[model samples]
Target: MVDYSILQKKYLVGTYVNRGLTFIAGEGVHLKDATGAAYLDLMSNYGVAIFGHGHPAVVERLTDQVRTLTTLHGSFANDRRAEAARRLTVRCGGGLARVFFSNSGSEANEAALKFAVLATGRRRFVACRRGYHGKTLGALSATDGRKFREAFEPLIWDVVFVPYGDIGALEAAVDDATAGFIVEPILGEGGIIVPETGYLKLASEICRARGALLLVDEVQTGAGRTGPFLASESEGIAYDILTLGKGLAGGIPFGATLVSRDVGERIPRSSHTSTFGGNPLAAAGVLAALDLLDEPMADHVRKVGAYFMAGLEAIGSGEIAAVRGRGLMIGVEVRSRRDDILKKLQDEKILAIPAAENVVRFLPPYVIRESHIDDALAKLAGILSGLSAGSPPPCAAS
Candidate 1:
C-alpha cells in the first residue's frame, strides 16, 4: 500500500477533517485511489467537477491554451477572455450584458459587493442566515455561518443576517440605505434547502423597491448542477448582479460576476480587479465548458435527477427522516448515525458530503450514469439496513 500519512501530517492543513481517501486519478464519474480501489464520485469535489474529472473537452482546451497563453494580467485584452465573456453573457439570457471575471467564487462575490457599493452608494448589505458566500473578508462577511465567521467578528459592520425564505424579514432588513441583498436561490452548502417558487421574485421586488440591488450567488448551483444554467434562472428571477463559479470551467478555477448593463455603467474600470482574473488558460476552459453544456445534457440531468430522488424515497424507512433538493443536488436526512453512515458509504465505495443539518449531500457530476445511481442506492440501502439494526458501522475510522 502507498503510504501518505507522513506527507499529510507534514504539509496538509488540518482545518478540514479529510475522509482519508487519497484519490490518485479519475475519469468520467469514478475516482481511483493510490491503492487502485475505485469509488463512484458523488460529491463531485464539493460541486466543482460538474462535468466530472478530466473531461476531454476541458482537458483539450486547457492543453491548447497553456501552449498559447497561460498567465496574463486582466489589463490587456485576450481573445479567449473576450470569447468567454461573450459566451457567458449570451447564456445568461436576459438583460445581464457585462461580466467581471475572477478566479474563485469568493472573488466573484467580492466583485459583486464592490459593484453594489458603487451603484447604490450604500455601505450595508443583507444576507440570509446559514447562507455561505465564501471565506474572504468581504464574502465571509456576507456568509451567515457562525462557526466560519465567529473567529472573525467585526466583519463588515453594515452586513445583516436575516431568516432565509422570510419575505417580511428580508423586506425589513433592506431599506433605502441598503447597498444590496445577496442570497442563494437554493442553499447549496447549507444543506440543499430550495426555497419556495416566488421567494426569490419577492426578494428581488423588495430590493428594487428599497433602492438596493439583488445579487444571486449561484456559485454551487450553477452550470447544469441544477438542470439549468443557473439556479436563479430556473426560479424565473433575474438579479442586478449574478455570480457563477464551481462548475464554470468543469473543475478549473473560474468565476464570474455578471453586472446588468445599468449596473455596469455606474462603476469605474479600476474599482476592482484580480491579477489572474480571466487569464487565457482558464478562459479557454470556460469557453469549452459553455459549449459542452448544451440543451440535451441539461434535459438528461432533469430526468436523471427525478429518477435518483425517487430511488432514494423508495429506500426510505423510519430511520430515514427526509429527502430534499432539486435537479441533481440532493440531500438525505437521517434520524441517527450521520457520521457513521458517511464512513460506511465510503467503505462501500460511494462518496457523499455531510450537510450542516445532519443531512447527506449528493452532488454527483452531470455525467453520472443510471447504473452509477443504482449502485449508489444499493450500497446505501445495505448500509442503512445494517445501521437500523443497531449494529455499529464497521468501517468508521478512529
Candidate 2:
C-alpha cells in the first residue's frame, strides 16, 4: 500500500501540523481511516462539520444542486443565491439587512473590516488579545497573535489590542478615529475562552457611544456551535457587522458578512466582489444546513456540552486546570503535557485538537450524545490517572 502521509508531505504545502492520520470516510460524529479504524470525531474539522459527515439532508440538497446549476456570476441573479441571502438575513435579524458572501471566514472578516472603515471613515480598529479573526492580510491586521502577524508587520490598518472580556480596556481603546471593534463571542482558537456574561452587550454600548461599529466574528461560534444561530444573539447584541463561516454551508466552503443598513449603504458597488462567492452550490448547502441546525439540535449541543464539561471536571485529576466553554466548543486546560494527552486520545481511537497552549479543545458535532461524551471521558480519565501515577504515556516509550 502506498504511504499516503509521505505523499502528502512531498506534494502538499507543509503549513499545517499534520496529525499523521488519514481519514477516508465519516458518518454521524465518527471518522474512518484508510485502515477502516473508526474514530469518534470531537474537533469536527475545526468546527466545520456541524451536522456531522454526509448528513442525509445536506447530501440530498447538495446533490440536487450539483445536478442542477452550480456556479453563476453575481451579475446575474440566481434563485438559490437570492433565497439563501433572504433566509440568512431574516435569521440573523438585528437590523442586518444585507450580506456579502465569500468563500472562507477570512474573506468574510475582511469584508466586515473594509465595510467598517468605509462606513465610519476611520482606519483604526480595536481587537482583543488572543482573539483570532483570520489570516488574510486585511483580517490579519485585526487578528492579535504575534506569531501570525509578526512577519507580516505593517498590516493593512492600525489596530489596537485589548484584553478579552475586559470592558474597561475596550472602552479605553476605542475613540473618534476607531472604525470598529472586532471580537469573538467565545475565543475559539484562543483556548475556547468564554467571556463574562454581558461582555458583548457592554462592548456594543461602548462602540455605539464612541461612534465605532461593532463587528462580531462568529465564524466558529455561529451556526449552532454555541447553542444559538450566533453566539452574539444570546447576548442580545445588535452589532453593526457580523461575519460567519465554518459550517454555514454544511461541509462546503462558504462565508458571509451581514451588515446593518447603515453600514451596508456605505459599501459602494465594486468595493468587494468574489467570482464564486454566492454560488448556487454553496447556497443550497446553506439552506440545508439551516434546516438541520434547528432549535432541537442546538438544545442537544447545550445539554451534551454541559454533560461533557461536568464529566471532565469530575475526573478529579490535579493535572486538569480547568474546563471552560459554551455549547459544544469546550476546552480542557491541562497543567502540562497537553500534546501528549492529545496523542494518547488518538491512540485510543478518539480525535481531538489543541487550542491556545495547554488546552485540549473539543468541537464535537451537535449530534454527539451523552454516550459519546462518556466514551471520550473514559479515555481521558484513564490518561489523567496514568499521568497522576507518574507513568509516561504508552506511546512515549515507543
Candidate 3:
C-alpha cells in the first residue's frame, strides 16, 4: 500500500494541518478511510457536504451533466445554468433579482464588495470583529482577524472593524463614505459565534438610514446548514446583498452573490466574469441541492440540531466552557486543549474541526440522525471526563 500522506507532504504546499487520515469513500454521513475504517463526519468538510457524501440526487444529476457539457463560459447561456439561477433567485426572494456565480466563497464576497462600491459610490466599508469573510484580498480587508490579515498588510480599500452584536459600534462605524457593511449571520470560522437576536435587522436599518448597503455573508450558514436557506432570513431583514457557498452546489466548487435589483443594475457589463462560473456540472449540483434542501429537510435539521446541542450540554464537563450555535452549526467552547479533544475524537472514529482558539466546531451534515449525534456525544463525554479526571490526553504532547 502507498503512503499518500508522505507524498502529499513532499509535493503539496504545507498550508493545512493534515489529520493523517485518507478518506477513500463516503456514503450518506459516514466516511471510509483507505483502510476501510468507517468514521462519522461532524465537520462536513467545513460545512460543504450538506446532503452528505454521494447523495443519490446529487450524484445522478452531476453524472448526467458531466456526460453532456461540463464547462462553458458565462458569456454563453446554458439550459442548466439558467434554470439553476432562476430557482436560486426565487428561493432567496427578498428583492434579490440577480446572481453572480463564482468558484468559491471568497470570490462571492469579493464580488459583493465591488458591487457595493459601485452601487453606493463609496470605497469605505464596515465589518464586525471576529467576523470571517474570506482570505482573498478584497474579502480579507473586511475579515477582522489579525492571524489571517497580518501577513498581507494594506489589503484592499478602507474597512472599519467594530464589535459584533453591538448596534452602537456598527452604527458609529458607518458614515457618509461607507459603501457597505459585510458580516456573517453566524461567525463560523470565528468559533460559531451567533449574534444577538434582531442584530441583523437592526444593522440593516442602520445601513439603509446611512445610505449604505448591507451584505450578509451566509457562506458558512447558508444552504440549510442553519435550518434555513439563509440565516439572515430568520431576522426579517432585507439585505442589499447576500453571499452563499459551501454546500450550495452539493460538494462542487460554487459561490453565488445574490443582489437586489437596484444593486444588480449598478453592476456594469464585463465588470466581472468567470470562465467556470456557471458551469453546467456545478449548475446541476445546485439544482439537486435546491430540490433536496426543502422545508422538511430544514425542519429536520432544526429538530436534530437542538437535540444534539442538548446532549452536549447534558455532558456538563468542566472542560467545556459553553455550548452554543443554531441548527446544525454547533460549537463546544472548551476551556483548553481544544486540539487535543479533536485528536481524541479522531482516534474514536469521528471527525471534527476546530475554530477560533478554543472551539470544537461541529458542522454536521443535515442528514445526521439522532443516533449519530448520540454516538458523537458519547465519545465527547468520555473524552471530557478523562480530561477532567487529570488523565493526559492521547495526543497532548503533539
Candidate 4:
C-alpha cells in the first residue's frame, strides 16, 4: 500500500502542520480515514463544511455543474455565476449592491482592499490588533500580529492597528486619509473573541463620521456560521463593504466581496480579474449553500450553539479557563498544555483545531445536533480529568 503521507511530505511544501491522519472520505459529520476509522469533525475544515461533507444537495449541485459547463471566463455570463452573484447582493443588502467573486478568503480580502483604495483614493487603512485577514500581501497589511507580518516587513500599504473592541481607540485611529477600516465581525484566529454589545455599530459610525469605508471582513463568520448570512447584520449598520468565504460555496473554493453601489461604480473596468473566480462549478456550490442557508437553519445554529456552550460551561473542569464565541465558532481556553489536550481529543476520535496560543477552537458544521455536542463534551471532560490527574497525554505534543 502506498504511504501517501510520506509521499506528500517528500514532494509537497512543508508549510502546514499535519495532524497525522489522512482522511479518505467524509459523510454527514464524520471523516473516515484510510484505516476505515471514523472521527467526529468539530473543526469543519476551518468552518468550510457548514452542511457537513458530501451533503446530497451540495454534491448534486456541484456534480450537475461539473457535467454541464465547468469553466467560463468572467467575460461570458454563466447561469449559476449570475444567480450566485445576484443572491449574494440581495442577502447582504445593507448598501451592498454588487459582488466580486474570487477563489478563497484571502482573495476576497485582497479585492476588498483594492476596491477600498480605488473608491476612496486613499492608501491608509485601520485594522484591529490580533485580527487576521489573510497571508497575501494586501490582506497581510491589515492583519495584525508580528508573526504574520514581521517576516514580510513593510507590507503593501500603511495600516494602523488599534485595540480590538475599543471604540475610543478606533475613534482616534480613523482619519480622512484612511481608505477603510477592515475588521472581522468576531475575531476568529484571535481566540474566538466576541466584542462588547453594539461594538460594530459604534465602529461603523466612527468610520462614517470620518469618511472612511467600513470594510467588514466576515470571511469566517459569514455563510450562516454565526447564525446569519453575515454576522454584522445584527448591528443594523449599513456596511460600506463586506467579504464572505469559507463555506460560502458548499466546500468549494469560493469567495465574494460585496460593495455598495458607490464603491462599485468607483472601481475601474478591467482593474482586477481572476480566471476561475466565478466559474460555473464554484457558482453552483454558492447557490446550493444559499439554498440550504435558510432562516430555520440559522435559528438551529443559534439554539444548538447555545446548548454546546452550556455543556462546555457545565463541565467545570480545572483546566478550562473560558468558553467563548458566537454560534458554532466556539473556543475553550485552557490553562496549560493546549497541544496535549488536542492530541488527547484526537486519540478519542473527536477532531478539533487550535487558535491563538491556548484556545481549542470548534467550528463544527451546522448539521451538528445535541447528541454530537454531548459526545464531545463527554470526551473532553474525560480528557481534562486525565490531565488534571497528571496522566501523560496519550501522544507527543502536536
Candidate 5:
C-alpha cells in the first residue's frame, strides 16, 4: 500500500505542518493509528470535532440523512435544512432571524463581510491585530497579521488593525465609514486572550452608536467550546452579524452566518449563495449536534473546564508564562521553547495545537474529564521538569 503521508507530500499542497503521524480510526476522544495505538486527542482537530469523533448520535443522524437525501440546491426548500436553520437561529438568539449556510468557517466569515457591506453601505472595516478569520480573500481581508496577509498584499477590502482586547483601540478604529468590526470572543488564534469583562458590551455599544455592525466570529468559541453555546451570549450583546463553524455540523464541514432581521432584509437575493451549503447530510448533523449539545453538556463543560484549567494553573513551572482561556479552549504561554514542549507532549501521545507565537493551545473535546486532565497535567509537569534539568523531549535534538 502507498504511504499516505508520502502520497500527501508528493501530490498535495505543502501548506500544513505535517505531523508525520496518521490515524486510521477514532472512538470517543482517542484516535488509533495503523499499529492500533491510541493517542489522546486534546485539540479535537483544531476544535472541529467538539462532541468527539464518531459520536453515536452524530453518526446515526448522518447515516440516516445519507440514506434519505444528501444534497439539494438552496433555491428549493427541504425539511432537514429548514429545521436546522430554524433551530440554529433560535439558539443563536440576539435578534438573529436568518441563516446562510456554507462549507467552512472561511465561507461563513466571507458571507458575514459581504452582508455587512451590503447593509451598511461601507467598505472600510475594523479587525483585531493577530486575529485569524480565514485565508480566503474576503475573510483574509478581515484577518490581521503579516504572516497570513503578506503574500496576498493589497487585500480587497479596506480594514484597519487594532490590538486585541483593547477597547480604546477598537473605538478609535471604528468610524462612520467602517461597515463592520469582526472579532473572536476569546481571541483564539491570538493566544486565547480572554479580554476583561465588559469589553464585548462596550464594543457592541460603540459599534451601534457609530452605526457600524458588530460582527462576532464564534468560529472557535461557539458550540460550547467556551462554556456557553456562544462566548458572546454571556455578554448579553446583540451582535448584528454572527458566524458559526468548526463542528457546528457534528464533524461535517459546515458554517452558518446569522444576521438580524434588519440586516437579513437588506441582503438582496442572488447576492451570495453556496452550492453545498445546508446539504441534507450536514443539516442532519447540525440538528443532532444541537440536540446533543444541550444544557447538561454545557454545565459539564463548565465543570470540567474549570477543573482542567485549575490543574494547569497549579503546575508551578517557571517555563510557563501564563495560562488563559475559557471552557475547553485553553492556552499556555511559555517562556521559551514552546514548540519543544509541544513535541514532548506529542511524544507522550498527548495531542495539542499551537496558537499565536508562544502559546500552547488546547481545544480539548468536551468529553474530557478530570482523569484526562490529570494524565495530561502529569505529562506536562514531567516535561517541564525535564526541560529545567537540561533534558528535552525524546526527539528534541534540534
Candidate 6:
C-alpha cells in the first residue's frame, strides 16, 4: 500500500487542505482503502458520483465508448454528441435545445456566461450573495463567495451581487445594461441554502421583463441530485441558459450549457470552444446516466432525503444549528467544531464534506440506501455527543 501522504505533499498542489485519507477504490455508496476497509461515501466525490462509484450502467457505457472512440475535437459533430444533446434537451424541456459541452461545471458556466453576453450584447451580470457558480474567470465573476474570488480581485466587468431570496434587491440590481442574472436554484457550496418559495419564479419573471437572461447554475444540484433532472423545475422556473455538471456523466467529467435556441443562434461559430469538450466517451456516459435518472433513482433521493432530514431535525443536538437542502444535497450547520465532527465520521467509516463556514455537507450518492443513512446518523450523533460534552475530536489538532 502506498502512503500517498508523502507523495502527495511532494507533487500535489496545496489548493485544498485535503482530508487525510488514501481511498483506493469505490462502489455504490462506499469507498475502500488499500486495506479494504469500507467507508460509506456521503460526499459522493463532491456530488460527482451521482450513481455512486462503479455503477454498472455508467461503467459499461464508458467502457464501450472508450473502445469505439475515446475522444474527438469539438470541430466536428459526432453521433454521441448529437444523441447526448437530444437527451439533455428532452430532459430539460421548454425549448432549451442547444448544448455546448465542456469538461467540468466551471467550464459549463463559463460557456453559459459567454452565451448570455452574445445573446444580450451586454456586459453586466447580477448574481446573488452566497451563491456559487464555478471557479473560472467568468464563472468566478458570477460566484459570490469572497474566498474563491478575492485573489483575483478584478474579475469580468460590471458584475453585481444581491441578497438571495430578496426580490426587491434583485429588482434593484437588474436593469437595461444587465445581460444576465445567474443563480443556483439551490445554493450548494453556500451551505445548501434553498431560496424562499416563489423566489426563483419571481427572479425569472423579473429577468424576462428586463430583457435579461435568467441563467441557472445547476452544477451541484442537477442530474437527479435534487430529485429532479434539473432543480429549477421545482419552482416551475425556465432559464434562458442552464449550466449543469457534477454527475452529468456520473463522474466521467462532463458538463454542458443548454441555451434557448434564440440565444444559441446569437453566438457565432468558434466563439468559444474546448479541445476536450463533447468527446464520445463523455457523451456516452451522460446518455447512460440520464437513462438511470429516469428510473427509481430520482424518487429514491426525494424519499430518502426527507427521511434523513427529519432524522437530523429529530436529533435536536445542541451542536447542530440547522439542517437544510432538497433531495440528497443536505447541509448541516453546527456551532461546534466542524472539522472534528467530520473526522469523527470519517473514523467511523462514513465520509462527509465541509462546506462554506460551519456547514457540514452530505451529498451522498443517489443510490444510497436507508442503511447508509442510519449508519451516517449514528456516527454523527456520537460525535455530536462528544462535542456537547466539551471534548474536541482528534482532527481539531490538524
Question: Model 4 compared with the native: what TM-score?
Answer: 0.97
lDDT of each: 0.88, 0.92, 0.92, 0.92, 0.92, 0.88
Off by over 4 Å in 3: 391-398
Candidate 6 has what TM-score?
Answer: 0.96
Model 1: what TM-score? 0.96
User: Which of candidates 4 and 6 is the stronger one according to TM-score?
Assistant: 4
Candidate 1: global Cα-lDDT? 0.88
Clashing pairs in 2: none
Deviation in Å, model 5, residue 309 alpha carbon: 0.7
Which pairs clash inside model 5?
Answer: none
The local lDDT score (0 to 100) that residue 228 gets in candidate 5 is: 89
The list of candidate 6 runs beyond 4 A from truth reads 391-398
Clashing pairs in model 4? none
Judged by lDDT against the true structure, how good is candidate 3? 0.92
Clashes within 3 Å, all models in order: 0, 0, 0, 0, 0, 0
Tell me how candidate 2 scores on lDDT: 0.92
Q: What 10-residue stretch in candidate 1 is worst by lDDT?
A: 389-398
Task: State the local distance difference test value for candidate 5.
Answer: 0.92
Tens digits of per-residue lDDT for model 1, 1-398: 54686678678788888777788899889899877788999998888888888998889888998899998888888999999999899898657889999989999999999999999899999998889999999999999887898899889747988988899899889999999999998887787788889888899889988899999898888888888887778456656999998878757788899989999999998999888889998889899889988899899888889889999999976568989888899999888788988999999899999987688999999988889999999999988888777755547634
lDDT: worst 10-residue window of model 6: 389-398
lDDT of 4 at 345: 96
